[model samples]
Target: MKRPGIMIKDVFKRLTMKPVTSKYPAEKSPAEPGYRGKMEFYVDKCISCGMCAKDCPSFACVMEEIDGKKRPVFYLDKCMFCAQCEESCPKDAIKMTTEYELAHLAGNPQIVK
Candidate 1:
């Protein structure tokens, strides 16, 4: 029903236009506000209540004995980044940072001491 030349015209128009996607690896994108990417643990504010470990869905948070005191160890390999630990911390010991580059070759967990 449409003219055959219309399809050709549309294709040519698209070909002359600039690309919309950015060069990712060569160029870093700015993170937006309130973006939850990574987790940061504050040992000074922690109370050893173990609430962060208890509410963690992925079991990424675990209380370990550190220098005769119980401390939280975070395993980023298994973490879902759901911010459950941040929400459950009554002492504001846990916080989320805008750091998403977590690629690693080592088979060890990222223990936050």
Candidate 2:
């Protein structure tokens, strides 16, 4: 059994405040410097070498045989958002970009070859 006057005062003050949330989509946000978004592979620069796969800390990177050639297959789901893949990359084939926003309602992130 609490006082009704106290409850009414708290509710009235909440309605007077300005909205604190940002309008997403309508108001886009930029990624911070060095932020890692989606990972893109440079096929031409890639020598089909297994160096990146062997050195990946999270094991998110893998190589698959395709028409007698080994190509990289990366699963973003397992990726730890660390820049290890980019640093261990000798050929500079794997580069990191600032892509922080990657939310989806339906499917997870996919990189098509």
Model 2 — which ten-residue stretch has the worst lDDT?
104-113
| Candidate achieving the largest TM-score | 1
Residues 3-45, candidate 1, lDDT per residue (tens digit)?
5676887799889999878898799976777888888888889
How many clashes show up per model?
A: 0, 0
What TM-score, to 2 decimals, does candidate 1 have?
0.82
TM-score of each: 0.82, 0.69
> What local distance difference test score does each model get?
0.87, 0.76
**Candidate 2 runs further than 4 Å off:** 1-21, 105-109
Tally clashes: model 1. 0
Error at 8, model 1, angstroms: 7.6
